[model samples]
Target: MPETNLPASKTSFVKGFDKWNIAVASGFYNQKIDYMIEEKKQELDEKNRKYIYKMLTFSLLIAFILFAISLYVSTYLEKYFLKYRKKIYKEVEKNKKKDILLAHQSKMVAMGEMMENIAHQWRQPLSIITTCASGMQLNKQLGLLT
Candidate 1:
């Protein structure tokens, strides 16, 4: 074997040192990549949280607005219903008075009709009585009866 300027053991140590340096650099690079990935994930989580918060706030605001509108509409409708009910009550009272008047008028008409019928029924009996009295007086004058 020919002898080189560098010893064989020293050359082997140099080669092994180079390999260890490469492995350390690779490990550092891998750690940096993992840190970057973790930072990106945190940023995404923060953005999602902000989006969810905005959505929840908007939903609550819309719900409050709808509730206020419904309350106003319901109050307005309730007042309108009360006014209408009062008007209906007045109309019902007027109808009741009219019904009573109509009933009184019906009774008056029925009484008038009954009085007329009674007068008609008595007229024939009164005429027969008058005729019988006159006949008795004439028989007495002619001595046909004691």
Candidate 2:
């Protein structure tokens, strides 16, 4: 067998690296992976959008059902218990008024009693003072004061 020699290609670092088929293949594979990842991301975004819309729709439906039920209950209450509720309120009001009237009457009676007591007290003291003054004047006129 005859010996054969091949010359090595001498190039700069940047050019040599770029010119290799491995680099080209790596770039192509990297680009393919990026594209695939972007496709999956788009699909996930679409799924998320659908899920959000469905959830929103479900929530709105539940809200509507609750509102309708509340309205129905309100009607039923108004139809059934309206008269009783008003009757209870009127009874309470009547009792309250009666209590107020009784309190007022009691206060007036107490005031009258207090006024009578005050008049009686003042009259007794005034009478005693007048009697003492008259006795003093009589003694003075009779020369008993000296």
Candidate 3:
């Protein structure tokens, strides 16, 4: 099975996280590892308890600050999006206008070709009409064009 990046909330983690510790909400994500180390230290004899506890506390504090900084960054990005959203929208419109102009140029070229073909088709008939008119005028001058 593929390893999914599901949140620690879904998958099992250390006892601290399983108990819904504040560290998880603070978003350090590494605090889970700290808690795991604490759990392993639980099996140790005596000297490790205070040290592990201090480590967990330090990890929690760092995680909280990291989460706060992350929140600030995300909020900054959101504000930037709000500020520049209209400019991005205008760029999209400009690109669309350019596409439409290109399409129009292509259509005009096709239309010019179609018109040229029509002129060519009509050229022979027009010439025939002029010739017949000239012949009739000559006949009339000879008294037969009426």
Candidate 4:
């Protein structure tokens, strides 16, 4: 290097300029970093919102499907119960008719037995009355009724 006569004030001014340049560059980088951080935060918030919306949609779809299936099952059960009820009613009616027929047959048999007993009771009384009347007629014909 050649020997040059540089003033102390000029050297101090150069040092101040370097410090000012470094400060300006650091401020610019700091501002850029802050902007990047804000953008990243906004992106994360948007993603979270979308995720929540998708979850809500999926849940609603599942609920609707469950509701539909329950309705179908209820309808099927109602129909099945109704069909069985009708069949049971028909069977009950048939059993009632059979019971009535059996009761009528029992009554007829009891009446027949009662008639036979009545005929047996009257037979002896009728035979005694006929014998007494015949004796009275024979006595009157022989003139012994005076």
TM-score of each: 0.67, 0.41, 0.46, 0.58
Q: Which should have the higher TM-score, number 3 or number 4?
A: 4
lDDT of 4 by residue, 15-125 (tens): 235655553222224444576999999999999999999999999999999999999999999999999999999999999999999999999999999998998789778
RMSD of each: 11.3, 15.5, 25.8, 11.8
Off by over 4 Å in 1: 1-28, 130-146
Q: What's model 1's TM-score?
A: 0.67
Better of 2 and 3 by TM-score: 3
Q: Residue pairs in steric clash, candidate 3?
A: 140-145
| lDDT assessment of candidate 4 | 0.81
Colliding residue pairs in candidate 1 = none
Number of the candidate with higher lDDT, 2 or 4:
2
What is the lDDT, from 0 to 100, of the residue 26 in candidate 3?
Answer: 30
What are the Cα lDDT values of the candidates?
0.82, 0.82, 0.80, 0.81
Worst 10 residues of 3 by lDDT: 20-29
Clashes, model 1: 0
